[model samples]
Target: MTRILLALLLILGFAAPAAAAGDQGWWNKDWSYRKQVTIDSSPSGINATGVIGRTVVLVRLHSGNFTFTDAMPNGADIRFVDTDNKTPLPFHIEHYDSTVGIATAWVAVPNLNGGEKHSIWLYFGAKTAPVAQDEKGTYDPDYMAVYHFGEGPGTASNDSTANANIAKSAPPGVDDAGIIGRAARFPGQGEVQIAESASLAMPAAAPFSFTAWVKPAQLAGTQAIFARGGLTIGLNAGVLFVSGPGVSLQGKAPVKQGDWNAIAFTTDGKEGHLYVNGLEQATGPAALGAIAGPATLGGAAGQPFTGELDEVRLSKTARPAAMIQAMADAEGKGGKLVTVTETAEKQSSGGGVFFFVLSKLEGVDEIVVGVCLILTAISAFVMYNRFAYFAKCTKGNAAFMRQFRRMDGELVPSAEIPGLDKKEARLIKTSPLAHIYDVGIEEFNRRKARLGNRPLSSQAIESMRAAASEVVVHENHKLDQWMVILTIAISGGPFIGLLGTVMGVMNTFGGVAMAGDVNVNAIAPGIAAALLATISGLFCAIPSLFGYNYLNSQVIPLASDMGIFIDQLLARIAETQAEEAADNAMGGFGDDDMAMMEMDDSF
Candidate 1:
């Protein structure tokens, strides 16, 4: 039992558990064509292609080591790099294949003899290899790449033999070299090459499909890929038909050049037709004789290819155009193509942020500011009213005093004035302080009642004047009290409000520090709230201060004037005292005595 347990434990320790599934690591990389090249006199080439929308990358290493750090699945399907710079012949990329390259796509390649072929795309990922240096400094070739696009030795002798025999590099009616003469891959002949090795025989009993990628090389070409006699059909950028004495069918819409175009050619052995991007572009008569070469890349023998060729394919049965179109659509929809569009579109949704921010301030801010400002304005107005009240009070008092003087102008004599008492007049003129008519008449009457029987004296009259002055001072100060009240209301309220603002600002900035930003977006609103209090305070304070000061300046002088008038009354009465004493003995104060009191008091 112990041995069994130990064995189980050992097995458990050594065994690996199933790993959690994860996202694919090969997403969106541009390793579509990573051909490893070792050029010996420019003989090396890469034969690879991608779907219409896929990326293709081809590299040549001259004896340098390469490292592919990408952790891809299946450890990569193909590696084609050569490190030693030893040039090799171009490798064929079976075009029109649907399951072998970076992306599986159906394509059609037309034969020079007019037979069409179909193949699919292939995928080859990254790998690494180290090279060794030679005595002549030429490194031993060691590299890892993905595909091998065909290469040319800059001459027919050094190039792939099949590429050296083309009858025509530019066929008749091919107007633009931009579409045709362009390199298939850099330094490789975009022109067609004909050779015996590229042809294959179609079987006697089966239908066929041909597929490849092409850019409409020329607007018009005699026979891009065609055949004659009993053996087949041809294919090309724009037209497809039998290469008879003269047989051609042009594409309804010319194959677009300067862009990768996917073409599919399918036939039921009776009617042969061409399809571009999954849409039937043209139809032609199939060769009605014995089957010849079933598949041929580039052009027919002696004719070879007059244009670039990659990923040529041939299927034993005709394929539907919709299936090819679906694949094309899929390629068009890949993230690589969409990425550029989405980036350029720049669909910013900041409106959401704006809405969210404004939502926070709904109603509260407007309501608060409105109420505060209104209250402040009202308070300010109240203070202003207080000042105006005092202003009116002072002016009224001054006018009242003047009117009193005017009324006193025809003052009733002691005899005529019904209000004067007899004791008030008996000693009114004998006193040295005589202008105190208001006080003397009252004092004598009061004296007569008890110890008031004593006669008046100049000192007593002077004391009376001083007493009236005090009363005037007290009365004058009454309306001016609003000054102090208004001053406190205006000045103090705003200060308090400012204090609130300071506190609010401190809180806002403090929170800002905690939140880690001082941007206007973060700070403006808080500062606005803080400042609201200050605004309220000022709104309350300004009028208060203005009115308070205005009232104070106004009321003080009125009080002073009243007191001065009272003093003057005493002096005028004093001057008339001797005359009044005689007149009192005569038992009368004439109109002159009252008139003089009124005039002196007006001063």
Candidate 2:
């Protein structure tokens, strides 16, 4: 038993250190809550590969994915940090409408390796947090112009980069229900134009990439989506086409009409590539001379596109195919590139496993668990008290029995016992056998005084026996005191716990029925909380059961000792009376009679 206990203690000691070591401490003490966001770029997810350094990825938050109430209104408290939990990342919120539970933010990851996984942190729940939006910092220097089309209907789209390449013309039309947010609408005649600038100038055969989410209203002949000097990206019969200074490339497969598709065109100075929905659809050798002109979206003139466009980005360096694919997978609707978990809070001074579990419990479940805890405490107290009482009784009885056996047929007064000492006397005071012997001796003296110089009759001895038996019964009562409390704890603790579990489960199912959603994610927490009640019940009952059995076993032996002591005490009193009677009979004759008897013996 000792070895088993030491082994368990060692295991617990090691486990605590391991748990503490795994915890990367909270990012900020003031922020109360955070969520872990995992960006999976493996084959099972986005499946992009290459050195995709300092990439900006979009993070979408909605009611299904985030708990809006825990965040401050307008989302000023929102902060993004790296997996190290110390380095703060650059991010900007494009849109946040807490009332409707929808928001969008862009975060620049320092490094995103292809075919691997990375993680970041989202911290919130602070009341006095400063706004940390860094629009230009969220994007790298390669991005020349990026437009989200989130401006008001009559306002020109604002560029998100440091170049300040704002649209020169306001969009002629606007669609509120665009892909990510509101989008710029085109009606085959109007266009969004950006004037020529130093940032927009393209040198001869320079590498560049352009991408936009487009939803075509019409797939008519050769409609332009973007065009500049010697460069045009248009659609004919819903198929993608890109034209440069020396080459023209067209995709064989047509994009689905009226559905949002990611259209991209890239030129590495000598070759051109066209992608639709993140997949490479067409490629060809394409070269470009100095292209310096104002850019037009929806068409240069009569070739205007009759469609809506959102999230148009222009990069000076030709982005890798994998980077483009990752962007498409992350920003599109129902994309699985990012996964966010439930919010976790920083542990306070009073926080531990018990408090954490209590946070998950509802009101009634709390009461149930509280009651179970009280019962457990009570049972523990009873067990300790009873165990101590039993130990004292056992020790005292053993000591008194030793002294009684050394009496050698004599019933001596307790104080006059030959080997008695302060410690032994104190022990014998608690002994039930000692008390019964005292009672028997008192009864023997009373009967002997009432019948002076006469032997005690069998009836007299039986009377003294009855008196000792009465004292034995009283001692047994003392031994059995407070034992019922242990029995109650053993039998009732589990049933109480079971009651709590039943109620918790009923409430959980009722909540699920009212919510009208049947997914595992929605119901798992409730079920786990319900099961905690049952676990608590078992915790209360099992220990009580063991304690009651052990204490009961100890009480039985003490009661048996009391009964045996009473029997020995009555038999000793009867034998002493018979010996006294024999002595009196031998002393009946005087000295003359003794001398006459001696002469007769000689004859």
Candidate 3:
């Protein structure tokens, strides 16, 4: 038992390191692929077999060893780090559904020649810290609304936030030459509006921030870029101004025409500040409560600004200088920003198995696994004991048979047989040949004593034959001992495991009902744990089944050998009796004389 425990511990110790190594290799890895698509231009637009142009394409990308729910990954989620040199194709990811492991990207294949093949190499995942969208490596939730203006013709521009405040353009058009893929383009006569909604209305005298990228083609008389009720911020003759009721704040520096510029403004009931290209240009006192009303971009009636605007963002909180600077750097052409499709936790980092197993396994699952472990131990012990016993029996039978064959016509006593020591007797106890020979020798000696020098009768020979047959049956029974344990293990292991799995699945659904959640996180653990029980059952049964089959094969041959030995022993006895009977018949001794002779020999 102590040795068994030590052997189990050794197995565990060796397995732990191997499992750890496998976990690392399984989790901390990346996948990559490369492809070339030939382009064919048409009058409508350039066409490719797959998503070749700057259109959004779904892609199924893998990073580690596990399967992700999302089958289709986005082309935008993948950046073409290396590609055939023609013109650098600009690509950006629009959305990445990490749950499904799918992403959407818009690839700009404008410069890619039609009817020409473009080679691309796509690399997935990274080992280093992920790049953040902002320098602080955090995304601010204070942004109540963010509009990239990446809408198609006649579609409303969506606000990328928890608050879905969509803006509708009057003419409904998308400009491709914006900071991102597309931006809302407002002609002089057109305007984009989001009627008086609670999401757009800033709380009275509350801190607020507004940022936009604007390029004015012509800065004539006062042209309003943004207006909310009487509060209006616009460019008036090459100068930016923020006006609310009777109070107005003006920028110190003048603005230029036909150039893209980042403009930002913030107010906290006390002061109003304006920033141009991330630099604070002016500051002024703000009214207690600026009038709030319907917000409009581009002049509604007479004063419409003639330019392109892109990337409009509005936040409810007054952002710190660091955050503003970070935003500027990130949105600017050159900035230290990390762009990833998913969060850091969702990325592959080689640490999932432990949590995955723990989270999924219920109380019943643990119990089932424990039961399986016990079954495995029992199965192992049974197989080892039975295998050893069979091997020993086989060896002893060979040795006893070899000695028996060498013996002459006269059977030797057990004590006189070569190599038949006390130790050999203990081992040969399970040997059918040894058992049969011992029975035959004892019976022959008893019959010979009764008949003295006269040969034994047919009845004495039949009695010896019956004794040998009985010994053969007993020896066969000994060979088949403890085999039922193997049968139990092989038959019961899988069913027990299945019961545990069924219970686990039932519990998983019950948990879902109780928690009111049906997501993968809520259910994957329980399902995986339940499945583990079935795997454990197989683990217990497979070896036992194999061992039982092999032992049965060995036992059948040994039983056959035992039957043959019994037959041979009976034949030898019958032949010896026939010779003796012939001698006695030829001598023709009287019954009284025979009786006196037997008595004298016995004395």
Candidate 4:
């Protein structure tokens, strides 16, 4: 039983370390960290309705949601993978400023169902990773022009889609403080235009959608935000209005002045709908003939918008309302549609169960846990050694007692017992009872030599018994050697562990108070790491308590056996001496001589 228990413990101590959390089949082993990105379209989130087919979604990263220090400069190491963690998805970075800790990337998702959640993986932290930006591939072919307005001043804005619909002229003004990154600021004087191309050309009554984030500086007369041929999406008296050849749709929901709003207009060739901030504001029958003109943004030849424009997109197909809603929910300020989880580090194959906890521990906590581990090792060693020693003593004592019982009344040496083999002889030599018997035999021989033929008196027998009793006491002291170490472990281990835990918790709260952010994520890891010290303490103490009791129980019986053997040895010596004295007193005349004389008289 002892062997089995020890074997199990040894196995646990040396078992192969496991990875942190379950295996998710990492996309690539080279990347050292990955974070899960979830896009929630459920009721609790954006609540987008209907199936939003393949589309490009923006992933915004800032100091609040991302750790900039983990990624390389300019986010060159960044890679987006699908939920399967094996397939890489196409993504392109629109803006990345590591020093400011803000970035925005657009990734093409295969599908997003309403009332459902979609997940993707963002892997980074590789030192030698190559740049994986796919600008053209990030947007579908239906997208005619997608402008981020992030280019430097006086430079024409480049389109991100496959269609190279660059701006015909630079913006008159540029605002670095735009909603996402940079925006084209129009002071109601000049406008940016895109020359008509095969991709930008809209046929008669064709499906079309135009969306942009607009912040109107003033709401007075009509201001054209977008226009091409006879199609014009403008703001009149702070209200949204879209007009084309035979289409005239006006929105009742007024655009908030001096604030950004997602303005969009989508027409399915039969009807046109206007949206403000992701909600449908107005709808009416609309149609258009073949349009032939350059697409103008921020103004036309007569009306110029006095505001900022950003993230302007033009699609050949009329985008679904759900997609527009999702975009508005995700790109708006302080949006919650996309949630990026905390980063997870890659674990080596040799990592242990406490590896993560230990990594989080402070220096003082590490020292405390180290002490507990040392105590655990000490206790295990003591328990194993003591148990083995007790087993040997028990076996030898049993063998010695058996041989001594067969001696009848003779006080003979343990080695001279009949039918004894070398093994039994060795057992008797190490047995405590055999040692006590040898002490008694030596004292008896000393008394016999001094008294000649006289028997030992009562005083001499008492003295000899006292000598044997002293040997039994000495044997018990030897049996109890090193048991104090177990007592120390049982009593002191928990207290030591508690000291570490208290110190760790103090450090954790102190750091939090210093940081002045009291969120659960900021405090949970520290508290959990602090508790590890207490666990280590219990780990050291529990097994020692059980082992101490078990070993002490085994020692008690052996000590009792030694005492009993001492008493029997003295009693047998006294009985043999008394018989010898009686025989001597009768002048050596045996019982046989008396019986023979009585028979002769009868004849």
Model 3 regions lying over 4 Å from their true place:
1-360, 418-430, 452-462, 580-603
Give lDDT tens digits, candidate 2, residues 1-603: 222221221222322211221234788877877778778889877788887677888887754345567789989999999989999999999888876556888899888888998999988889899898899998898898999999988999899999999999888889876777778998888889998989887898888889999999978788888898868898988899987677699998888889889989888888889998889999988777788889998777768788899999998888888788888877776565776653345535223333333344655666666666666667788889888888888888888889988888667766678878899999988877788888888888877788754666778778877888888788777777776766776677678767877887777666544322233433455555666666666666788789988987998888888777777877777778778878888889899999999999999
**Ten consecutive residues with minimal summed lDDT in candidate 4?**
1-10
lDDT of 4 by residue, 150-254 (tens): 998999888988899999899888988787778899999888989989998888988889999999999999999998888889999889998878799899967
Per-residue CA lDDT of model 3 for 353-436, tens digit only, reads 434443345557777767766777887887888788888888888878777777656676555686577877666665667878
RMSD, candidate 3, Å: 18.0
| Model 1 per-residue lDDT tens digits across residues 1-603 | 212221222221432232221223222133332222211111121111222221121121100111112213322333322222222112222211112112111111111111111211222333332221111111111100111122233422112122222232322222111111112421122333323323333544346665555543443443344332333344443444343322234466555544546666666666667777656777776543445422233445544334443323444455555434533332321211101000000011122222222222213333433444554555556666755565555444443344335433233323344444564444433322222234544543444355422344777676666666555545645555445556566657676666767776676566444332234444565565566556555655675667667666766665556556676665544444445455555555578897997899999
Candidate 3 TM-score, true structure as reference:
0.43
The C-alpha RMSD of each candidate to the native structure, in angstroms, is: 26.8, 11.2, 18.0, 11.8
Model 2 regions lying over 4 Å from their true place: 1-24, 347-603
Error of 2 at 561 (Å): 49
TM-score of predicted model 4? 0.57
In terms of lDDT, model 1 sits at 0.39
Output the better candidate (1/2) by TM-score.
Answer: 2
Q: Estimate the lDDT of model 2.
A: 0.77
For model 2, where is the 10-residue window of minimal lDDT? 12-21
Candidates' TM-scores? 0.31, 0.57, 0.43, 0.57
